[model samples]
Target chain A: MIRGLVRTAFFVAFCAVIGPAYAQGPLQLASDVFVEREIAKPDGTKAKLLEEPKTVVPGDQLVFVVRYKNVGTATASNFVVTNPMPRAVRFDGTADGAELVSVDGGKNWGALATLRIAQSNGGDRAATSADVTHLKWNFNQPLSAGAEGKLIFRGVVR
Target chain B: MDNIFAFRRNNRPARNHRLALGTSLSLLLLTVSAPAFAAGTVAGTDIQNIASATFDSPVGPVTIDSNTVVIKVDELLDVTVVTTDPGDVITNPGQTGNVQAFRITNTGNGDEAFSLVANTANGGDDFDPSLQQIIIDSNNNGVYDAGVDVVYVAGSNEPVVAPDQSKTIFVITSTPAGVANGNRANVSLLASAVTGTGTPGTSFAGQGQGGGDAVVGSTGADAQASSFLAVQSASVTLTKSATIADPFGGQRPVPGAIVTYRLVATVSGAGTLNNLAINDPIPAGSTYQAGSLTLQVAASPATTLTDAADADAGNFNGTRIAVSAGNVPAGETRTVTFRVVIQ
Candidate 1:
């Protein structure tokens, strides 16, 4: 079972070109990607932050920032954004304060502690940074034309 | 290297060679000696599979799973302790600063730190002696020179025993200020792969970057027993016989008769025969039966064998048999038997 979750690595998705069974409305999903780092404010506060990571070593803190915008003219409802936690890092928690759900390449979603993957020893171990195979964020609000929102989660370089 | 959580015989190469070589069936023998960190090979830790995040968007439950993220895992941890000498033998009133040598190898897939311990046989046959200290052969030379080798202190172990790399270690014992002539001591070197410092309970620390969680093996200990022998004495007796049962139904050998050869080796002496290897070849005019070899000892009933190296008990490849009778304690007996068909 854990191997199933582990295979989530190097995962690739195939897209099916459904010939215009019907003229489906346009939905343009544009995205922006950046790497963020928290910096300290001159006032002795760590409020100031920066982006762009040139190099990173083990046990370093890194935040992934991805912005998604719906550029289509019609409104897009129930837009769910999923960011497969990078293999090199762990999905510790949400840095953007958004409610989140994690999966071990399975259907169940819950707190990281409640999730488990099959251990090699014929037992189940609670999910860890290594166990969390994916992360998801739900935007219940509708996205009108030209509306955009940011989805950000915090992870540590393993 | 076998299934981490599965049951298997524990054939550790500890100080007791004979005992260590005793092989057992994987299912019948389940020794919780190996750490549970190892699993489905190396690449499994870094899952390359992808995740799916779906939500309703009119067309269907669209799962825009994030890009495939192969979770990286830390390096695995493992270690082994061994010695070249068969067994150390010395007379009582042993000299101070007397040293025995050993080597600890990092058997894991990643770099690891090992903490060592040298213990003396608390109390046994005659008496006990004092243990000065255990040292790491920093210079790679076997000899233990005060300044050349660094003394092993509590809480401080080897810095880095790289994967597949070995480091020499020495155990030095000093004769007490005033001691009796007949005294003994058993010293062992233990190597524990240092765990990483992470979510202590959640996952293994001490793992290579992007490696799996940490779980140290039971322990890798190679013992060096220091004896104060009043006299160099050791005697091992081997007695073998063949019993035949064939179409004739009598003890006499016949064309289709199966010959079962049984040999009992008994040791009676103060000194120990560390490696009691039993070698036998198929007799002439007879064809050797494969997988019919086995070892049995009344004292240690649990140690059984099949013919394989990883089996530990002993190994035979039809033509010849090489069984390792680890360390046969005084008054202990080991019995090995095999079957061959008379041509």
Candidate 2:
């Protein structure tokens, strides 16, 4: 009876340890946000972004990029992101170059066309709303585990 | 042995039940703790680090405003009096006259409002009262007598001045004919203006009156006033002039050759020019030869040229000749000459 009890206790402890490991699997999510000077390198190594505080003169265009990866066993689905714009800075656009997202703080997004037709006519250019300083990226498709993605936005210092 | 075997068989089922219960409890604990730990760790790292990183920048200094004043003489007062007796009736009769004027102005960046009160000091002769009464001490005494005091002719006092504004006051007097033309007098013009005022509660009442009243109601928080006085001596005189040929033999200087030339100046004004100094600048392409200057005035026998040869000589290096006239008398002329060579 004592031997049976010992075996039973051992089995219970083993299950406790293995169950969490099995449930968690290889799921992981990591994100890095930074700024870089050059976009390319000849040696196959890209230039790293500077992490120090930088002074940007007026009328300078600043580009920020965020890289995210799903280093997990399961897919990351319905990914959503939001960034707030800093004071004394303005967003440029969003059409691969620039774009207008929405009126309700980027809750709903469409191409610049829909925004222009609704806010201004096709004749007028789209501008960032006063309250909207941040840039956001949302994905409708799932990111397979181990897949990576990046989002970029441009702003001008006033 | 038979009893032990039977006990083992009875406990097996109970052991299995206990194992199942332990596993379920372990799983439940991990499930509850995982979400809490994840949320706390992520938020703690991001929010706290960012909050600390963003801070305040420092600031620097600021600036203010200021002003200044300068006075210059434009034209000297020239007074001439001629007396004629219809029948040459009185012998040794005397009369006095004078010409006086003051050039006061604001040559600074801002407007200045000020006042002037002048008093004549007794040296020897009396300031003539017949002249415009900017100020005068007639009895050779140091006190001002209201009844006998001369008043500023018509428009002597200026109330206000914009930047670079100026005003001139004139006074003139005539002397009786047959009076010896050797009389002399000293005159003084004292000018003062308030610049600023102290704080509202500060008391500036104890500062004596006179020109200080000019800045009484000024907006400046600190009231300040400047007082300056200039003294001039008046006299009667005779004058003469003469020109001597080039002291150094005249030679037409070649394009690059240097030739020395000389010239003299004589003064016959009422008052001998005190601390008389003259500046003669050589033409742009000229140079002064060494030791080519001399003073020939009998009254100013101890005169010297305060310039060195080979120097540019005209306002060049701010050099000139200075002379002292030991009370030159009326109707006499004194002369000084210096030489420079043209390069």
Candidate 3:
């Protein structure tokens, strides 16, 4: 009986420590748009492009950076992060060279041409920019503790 | 008083000038008297050279050579082209040597050089404007001729326009001497950033490169374009014939015979001719036949006589026959018929 009581206490202690930790996650996401500027280095050869940005206007190419970090003590599981391409901007999928899927409001996915959209004339046509609703990246690996990286894609403000 | 800009802006010119003078005088005394004060201290109070410069640099100074350093901050690049016309219009085989004006604005923060291009077959036009020349309105008189305006410099160092400034351009296009009737053309004036043109087809100078450049508007073309119309003028022809009926009730041309005169006006082009007025003086030794004037337009019925006015269709203006046809559309004809009695 005493041994049984001790096992119960140990189990309870384990649950107390691990349950809250499992419930709380540390994978955070931060995204912003930045314009590329050519910055002159102190060496003064020519200049190198650095990410210093201000206001964005029409026809200006912008880089959208998504930074993720695992600030937890344990590793994180496989997950997917999605960012809706702002309707004001157009995404060409080459900005960060990341594997991406295009989504429609109604569950459709694939490339720009293979996807089909409904036409007002009661017919289906190849999907275009209006079909692109969201961009998603599926992380295959386990996120280690203190791991941080960036995912970027390019777009132009419409 | 709370805002720095407001303080400066609200300050009077005299006060600002006095403050600026005081600051300049203090700085001048400090700079000019420095060498004299140094000499007074070195030689126990004496004279000195007024013109001398001090040095401070990474390399230790040998007090030998005088050199100057210069610094420049890179400028922003922006430019735009727009037409002041509510609509660009010209006539073909019509008005020769006409001018269509446009304004090119430099919206950049720095001075810019623009490359001018005149295109007859530019994009987004149903037809191409047969261009003659594009000139800078040097005299600001809004006219273009050989010596009156400087012709456009093709793809080279052109005008250097300052920031937030504009230049007047006169696009010279014409309906050729023998252009076909109803011919229409389009002329597009495009300006590009020649701020740093080295080669022929380079896009533009990068920002802060000490060159000139501007971001093109949303049209995806580096230059702004507005097309002007050149339409062929409607050809107008007038034919007159006279038939005389004597007291014997037959057609004759002699005196004492009633002469019936028919004047036909025909127009040919793509546009309507408005405010068309035709006047014919009564032939000598002839008296107009009262109530005999009749006007007939192509699409409408005929009308009887009236009097001289801006609105009357047919009238007699004291020894003359007048027809005031408001607008005779293209491919239509107007006929005025009246009788005159031979004296």
lDDT per model vs. reference:
0.54, 0.35, 0.55
What are the per-residue Cα lDDT tens digits for candidate 1 across B23-65?
1111111221212222212312432223233334554434333
Residue B189, candidate 1: Cα error in Å is 16
Report the poorest 10 consecutive residues by lDDT, candidate 2 chain B.
Answer: B47-56
Candidate 3: misplaced stretches above 4 Å? A1-158, B1-74, B122-129, B139-146, B155-157, B178-182, B196-221, B237-259, B266-343
How close to the true structure is residue B249 of candidate 2, measured as C-alpha lDDT?
43
TM-score of 3: 0.38
Off by over 4 Å in 2: A1-52, A94-100, A116-134, B1-343
> The CA-based lDDT of model 3 is what?
0.55
Evaluate model 1: give its TM-score.
0.33
- For model 2, residues A63-94, the per-residue Cα lDDT tens digits are 54434555455665555444444433345653
Candidate 1: lDDT over CA atoms? 0.54
Q: Candidate 1: lDDT of B290?
A: 75
Q: Candidate 2 DockQ category?
A: incorrect
Give the lDDT ranking, best first.
3, 1, 2
Model 1 is docked with a DockQ of: 0.08
Per-candidate TM equals 0.33, 0.23, 0.38
Q: In DockQ terms, which candidate is top?
A: 1
